[model samples]
Target chain A: MERLILRVTTKLLFAPIILFALYVQFHGDYGPGGGFQAGVIFAVAFILHAFCYGLDETKKAVPQKALTVAMVIGLLFYVGTGVATMLLGANLLGYDSIDPDSTHHAGQHYGILLVEWGVGMCVASTMMTIFYHFTGREPDINQEDW
Target chain B: MSAFEVELTPIVFLDLSLLTMLILVAFAMLRSRHLFAVVMLSGIYSLLSAAFFVSLDAVDVAFTEAAVGAGVSTVLMLAGMLLTARREKPKTPGRAPVALAVVFVTGAALAYATIDMPAFGDPDAPANSYVGQQYVDETPNDIAVPNIVTAVLASYRGFDTMGETMVIFTAGVAVMLLLGLGSARGGREVSDAEPEDGEAK
Candidate 1:
């Protein structure tokens, strides 16, 4: 796991992985990607880091508290959009009133974007949280057991 | 001959080949005794299915299958295997006949059930005819999104997506509760999980 080749490859690949995840997240509107796919892809970059550099190193970079907060924030972001729309006199998640006088298209676009971003945030952190917890466990079997 | 013929178009050939490979991988997974190999085979299964989904023109589902199913799940399973035995424990053969019978009955029942369903992608099929058509027709004007799936998922059915997000959040929380996030190095949970030597007694 500590081979020089693996370490160098991970370092080179990490930023691009995150960049691709972001592309899948925002570019989803015009394409086949979406929040769920983007979130999982984003989580993957961190998982790759943990795989090469060891779990402790990755944890130091992304604190468990930060992931927890991110998980909550993403959910709240989605709900907050709905609340804002509601207060704006639109029904829950109803985007018509978001752009009252003009064409309702812009309203729908913005509403979809807002909610999708929230979903992406929640999914990414939740996945990272799962990966962290799973890998943090003490091994039950020794090398000889394998 | 006419009744037995299926036009072997390139798309049909590609589909048959993919399905054959998928079935082969599944059989390999079933026969493998090594847990690690089985996990790797399962990842292969996911990748094959992702390819199949792309062939079916469901790119978003293919993306998810490739990412979560093949990538993260494989890593997670390997981590899980680290906590358990590398080799699968020998299963007792006493129930093999009953299990085989049950599987055969279930497969036959499912195959029979599909006989009454409309042909694949039929224009008049209930699913293709109703709200699905409306969504496709009205998305440009109503939701104003190019990707109808995105428009429908994020807006037309926003509540459902919120619920799905909450479900993912809940799963993360449940994992944290069961296996606290290694915060303080799982100081208390580690003690609780210590190997019990005399539990059988």
Candidate 2:
């Protein structure tokens, strides 16, 4: 865990991986990726960090509070969008009133982006939460076993 | 040309090649006695299937499989395998034939069912006959997102995707309940002296 190579490589790769995850998330409307893929990719970056650094250090960096909040907020954001549409006198998740204009795609492009964002946030953090739980009990792994 | 001769399209050749690779990886996974080798082979199988998904024009699914399947699940499996035995013990020899017979019959039944299903992209197919037609025709004017899959998943069927997100949320909650993370930040868990596995296990 204290090796120079892994630390350096992880440091180099972490930012780019996060950046790519964001690209996959936001660009989902026009391209192949969406929340699920982006979320996993995002979690993988931090998991890579955990691999290089200790889990305790990774937890300190991300903090348990932020992770749980993100996990909760993601679902809330998705449901909130539907509730907003309903409040606007449209059906649940209907795109028409979201934009309030006849043209401009009924705000669907933005709608997709927001929903995907919620999904990405939830997925990424939930995956991290799972990782934390499963590997929280992993201090027993010897340095050689790794 | 002989009547038996068949020329496959390039896409078909790619799909067949990927399927062959998938089968080989699956067999390798099954036959491998080492748990580590089996986990690694499963990752390879996932990557092969991701490629197969791309060949079928499902890039989103391919991305998901490559990330969650080949990447995340592989790491998770390795972590899980560390807690268990390193090698798989052989089962009783007598059950092998019966197991093989059951597998063969199940596989045959599944294949037979596929034969009665509609061919790829048949316009009159049951799937294409329903709301799929309306979505395909109106998606451009309705949602305007080029990715119809996203448009459908996030917009037209938003309720379903909300459920998916809720599923992920519930998974986090369940894991938290079982494993106990984040709830007791200040009250308990003050001891760093004890290793996690000793107490947890």
Candidate 3:
């Protein structure tokens, strides 16, 4: 009964934070918020949930291995955007040179979106990855405690 | 120039407010006893610094500050605290006094140097001439980004971003190695056990 109560309360507190993060992510272009702030807010929400519901439960939601993979994938996505621009006969990160047809305006939008998604992924996953490192069980500690 | 012609109303007030917040937060961070409180205060300090940057019209810098300084740095510091105790050790006077004195003198010297510097946001400053103008003007055509800072950072300064990414990757690797995470395969065992009787402080 106590565990159920804790779980319910944790979910209640975390829901608003998640919603705010999404708001920040989508509203970044026009306001003071951006991908990085949104990513941090998202990570903080997860970290709070982890603290309340135990690291094991948190891991079930976002596994450590999965987070590691996400981090790498995020970085690759960022770099790959640049590489794609290069392949399209543009200088490094030269979005204008990417699409020769439509004055490259569309390409710029596409490139920014891809890069922002990459940054958001990296920031969020890396934050969670660091949290996992600290909260994860330590074999040495168990031995010492026992 | 007539004294009446030089207006210093809102800008001066805003600058002073920013400076006050920065000083107060820095002092609070220094004097806080709880590690968590100190970490949170540091984040507040970073936010204040970001605001200052924005007021100075360095939007790109302000964005980076809000992101890396307030966001990533706070997370990293909190993670570090989790690996150790939350209480700060009492200060000792042995070598700390000398270190504090050195820091104070260096800070004073830097402040003195800035006293003769151009007022904030001076239009005729050298920074407004060489690269800043180019970045602001050509960003739309050169990089095709509406945000000049984004264009400057990702395209014009691509090499620096690559280096920064590598640094982050290196720090991640170092943490993993230090925590002995390289070869550990088994899942972490969840501990619901309460603190021991004597361990509770």
Candidates in order, TM-scores: namely: 0.90, 0.87, 0.77
Please write out the lDDT profile of model 1 over residues B1-201, one tens digit for every residue: 012334557877788899999999999999888999999999999999999999978888898899989998999899888888789877776667888999999999999999777766466777787998999899888887788889889999999999999999999999888878447354455545655787752
True contacts kept of 1: 0.86
lDDT of 2 by residue, A1-146 (tens): 46899999999999999999999999998899999999999999999999989888999999767998998889888888888889989998886777877575857877788889999999999999888878876446554675
iRMSD of all candidate structures: 2.2, 3.2, 4.1
Give residue B183's error in model 1 in angstroms: 1.4
Model 3 lDDT at residue B8: 84
Superior candidate under lDDT, 1 versus 2: 1
Task: Give the alpha carbon lDDT tens digit for every residue of A1-146 in model 3.
Answer: 65787778778879898888777665543345545667777888888787677778888998777877777877787788788878888876666665657664666656655665666677788777766776673524422353
User: How many clashing residue pairs are found in candidate 1?
Assistant: 0
Give the CAPRI class of candidate 2: medium
- Regions more than 4 Å wrong, model 3: A1-35, A137-146, B1-6, B57-72, B94-101, B180-201
Candidate 2 lDDT score at position B122: 59
TM-score of chain A of 2: 0.90
lDDT of 1 at A50: 92
Model 1: CA > 4 A from native: A141-146, B1-7, B181-201
Q: Which predicted model would earn the best DockQ?
A: 1
What are the per-model DockQ values? Answer: 0.68, 0.57, 0.28
